[model samples]
Target: MLYYTIWTLFYSVNFHTSMVIMFSHINHKPFLGAIHDSLSLLFL
Candidate 1:
C-alpha cells in the first residue's frame, strides 16, 4: 500500500510537469495558424 501511494504521487507529478512543458511550448508558437487552430477548438 505504501508503494502504491508513492507511485501514484510520482506519476501525477510527472504528468503535471509534462503538461506544463507542453503548454509553455504551445504558448511560444511562432505562427498564428497554430494558435488559431487551438483557439478554434477551445471556443467550439
Candidate 2:
C-alpha cells in the first residue's frame, strides 16, 4: 500500500510537470496535439 501511494504521487507530479513543460513550448506541437486528441476522445 505504501509503495502504491508513493508511485501514484510520483507519477502525478511527474506527469503534471511534463504536461506543463509541454504546454510552455511552441515547438512541441505534436505532443500538444496528441494530448488534445486524447482529451477529446475521453470526453466523447
Candidate 1, residues 1-44, lDDT tens digits: the string is 99999999999888755655566587875455555655576689
Clashing pairs in 1: none
How many angstroms is residue 12 displaced in model 2 relative to the true structure, after the best TM-score fit? 0.5
Using TM-score as the measure, which candidate wins? 1
Where does the lowest 10-residue lDDT sum fall in candidate 1? 30-39
Candidate lDDT scores, in order, read 0.68, 0.71
Q: Number of backbone collisions per candidate, in order?
A: 0, 0
| All models, RMSD in angstroms | 7.0, 5.2
lDDT of 2 by residue, 1-44 (tens): 99999999999888865765666464556776756754676589
For candidate 1, report its TM-score: 0.63
Clash count, predicted structure 1: 0
